[model samples]
Target: METTFKNKVALVTGGASGIGRATALAFAKKGAKVAVVDWMENDEMVNLIKELGSEAIFIKCDVSKIDDVKAMVAQIIAAFGRLDYAFNNAGIEGASAATQDCSEENWDKTIGVNLKGVWLCMKYEIPEILKQGKGAIVNCASVAGMIGFAGLPAYVASKHGIVGLTKTTALECATQGIRVNVVCPGVIQTPMIDRLTGKTKEGIERFKGFEPIGRFGLPEEIANAVVWMCSDEASFVTGHVMAVDGGFTAQ
Candidate 1:
């Protein structure tokens, strides 16, 4: 978390693609070793980080599972020796259905991955970060975390949970030299959005209208915020729920 430091290492969950991959590369570009964690393995991101002139390793992890999360952090320590920053960015957009029509299965899986997964990552990542004497954590929430959305009961609820959890954890770690915060990204152009929009022009335009900026944000934009939140530049920032939504939340 220090502004000027060396031998720093970072962990990014869901680092296989989108914002995760961007953030992982962002760290690597800054000379920090990175651990790219995702449910599915992608050696490309890892290899790309190496190309950026930094060290990187890909770990296949389902953050929703405790055992997997536990081992994921351990592997990071074993590979990089210490952890200074963490981006708990892994999440899923559950089946879109109205609250009343939402299924138990959808609810469970959504909460498990989006909500419990962040908690589980923090549960294991916090102790390791604490060992380093000082560090920072940035959890990924969403614009949905700030406001209600139709036909996404579970996703909305999980993101809201992340906002609360980040604040609580920030308070707990504030005195211990560990900063905790959450990033509520706006409508970013990523594979997730591609799926949500069905990769169609109309669907994309429909969602793009959701942004007050009159356009969708790139993954690098969100990644920039995440990287800053974990750096000394944001040392005074904790328990902050940043809405990098290009004025979407402003309106």
Candidate 2:
């Protein structure tokens, strides 16, 4: 495997599962120390990283809260001594409903975790990366961010907000040795999608039909794009909203 990231440090929020987990492992496989932050415990993931010959720590955090994000960064620095890369991937898909029928609570919850959470992660993570003299940050967005998805106003809005936030932040930090970008994923095969689609065969097939590829994307597919964004291979790339959507957005 490529050790382009040897001796680097990477932080992945929502690292308990799905794209977050896959990206964390990718960082580990590339010889980077990893800090996996999520609301859930993921001992198995941490252990797997260790088995890959990289050090890893699982930090429990609810990305929506300011204090949690602050403490999460502090803990990462304490454990690894520096931060070089960050994947602000923690998010939620709120209850699906039309704008007129969506509940206020759902809107708050979705924006809280998906949009505010990314801002908070960057707020703390950027400083640490600056201290290290250079770093890269990839925020998790969705195809919903780039286009309208009926019945998902809150999710779509939050994702669109992330893209805007990422672009603005990238401009602010462009000369500061920190790169910020966003990945707009299509219908990925993650538990989140499963839950959103009710976990039924019909639901799964319907969701797959939305992707022109005739299948749902794997978390590893998104992980590969994320790791590349954080790697030197993308040194000249920043403020980019890359879509890994199997042509979902192209149509």
Candidate 3:
């Protein structure tokens, strides 16, 4: 897939770390100019892309806010000129709590970022990609979207929303030169997982046991799926829910 994206532009949100960071570099490696968007300030991400012999820029924006998302797309245009792919990967693993115990703030914030954030990005991004006559989008959901977890009601709901949203949007744009899909990753080894596991040997092992593959997936694995889905190699695929879950979901 190297050089498939030559002279193209790809946008990634929550790209300061983890899967987002991995996908940003993957795009660069494929010769696409990358725009790394994250609420956190991580200069090294952009610097690393430059070191990879690709063009890049960093845009800090809260994807939940319309104004911020609009500005983000605008910055991409200003920096890279056009957009061909997007990975709506900005998300949070909200506080683990039962449905009755989950706070409204937690629910709202989680939904705003994971679900609404993807919607807002697509709302603006589709127009730009339309200008080019063709593009692809991959929204990051999770296995939690397909199944329920006792302590993660909010996260589950938001991701489920992403699943439905992706399908509906894909159908709406299937003939519009834009293909949309969602990725459902299971137990990836990332800062998010670190927080979930409390960085404890026991905590990590407990979660790893959940993976039928017997190991936590690497961020790069998820990045590879997102990149491929956005590539012309996946031209016939759309409205797809891909699980890069190490067989966790199959069980």
Candidate 4:
């Protein structure tokens, strides 16, 4: 069978590591020309995409900034001629603290990158997708978005904003053939998680018990859901918050 993304172009913010890296590779494997966008350099990921027999480019961008986001989209279109898919996955897990104890700096930083970042990306990306006449966009929210999590007020608030943003964008673009959706991932095994848990065996186990599945989710698993959302199989699906949380939210 032919690959679903053959000859298409896909952009992934935060494509340097973790779920972003996994999703970028997945898009390439399905025959999409991939643009790996992140604040960090990802020469290794670019090489890996070439090894997958697909074209790839690395664009350094801090998605929270309007100038950076606009330039990022311009570069992608300049390189690939058209954009068919996008994953706005650049984000940070801010300082863990109670709402009252959370510093304004942490709140601003978290909301800036996680919520404003997604909005900035969509602001530029949607017009491009409209140029194509049809396309898909997926923003990375979190299980924290669906439910409240103590000691993470800023992070939780930003993710909740993303869910609302996704829904509104979906409705705005639905009739125009553009689809917008958000993915809510549980505790996925990624560098960010390592930062959160210190990569210790006990720390890992503690997070594992948070989910009914008895284990942390893998980045590739979330990648699978992301690719599927951008595929024709999900053509009828938009404005949905699909959780790839391995029963975390099912509780």
Itemize residue pairs with steric clashes in candidate 2: none
Q: Per-residue lDDT for 1-251 in model 3, tens only?
A: 44388899999999999999999999999999999999988899989999999999999999999999999999999877899999999999999998999999999999999999999999999999999999999999999989998999989999999999999999999999999999999999999999999999999999999998899999999999999999999999999999999998899
Worst 10 residues of 4 by lDDT: 1-10
In model 1, the Cα lDDT at residue 186 comes to 88
Look at candidate 4 and give me any clashing residue pairs. Answer: none
lDDT order of candidates, best first? Answer: 3, 4, 2, 1
Return the lDDT, model 2, position 62. 94
Q: Give the RMSD in angstroms, all C-alphas superposed, for model 3.
A: 0.9
Best model number under TM-score: 3
lDDT of candidate 4?
A: 0.94
lDDT of each: 0.92, 0.94, 0.95, 0.94
Stronger candidate by lDDT (2 vs 3): 3
Per-residue lDDT over 110-196 for candidate 2, one digit per residue giving the tens place of the 0 to 100 score: 999999999999999999999988889999999988999899999999999999999999999999999999999999999999898
lDDT of candidate 4 over 1-251, digit per residue (tens):
34479989999999999999999999999999999999987699999999999999999999989999999999999999999899999999999999999999999999999999999999999999999889999999999999999999999999999999999999999999999999999999998899888988888888888889888899999999999999888889999999998899999
Worst 10 residues of 3 by lDDT: 1-10
Q: Which residue pairs show backbone clashes in model 3?
A: none
Candidate whose lDDT is highest: 3
After superposition, the stretches of candidate 4 with alpha carbons farther than 4 Å from their true spots are: 1-3
- TM-scores of the models, in the order given: 0.97, 0.98, 0.98, 0.98
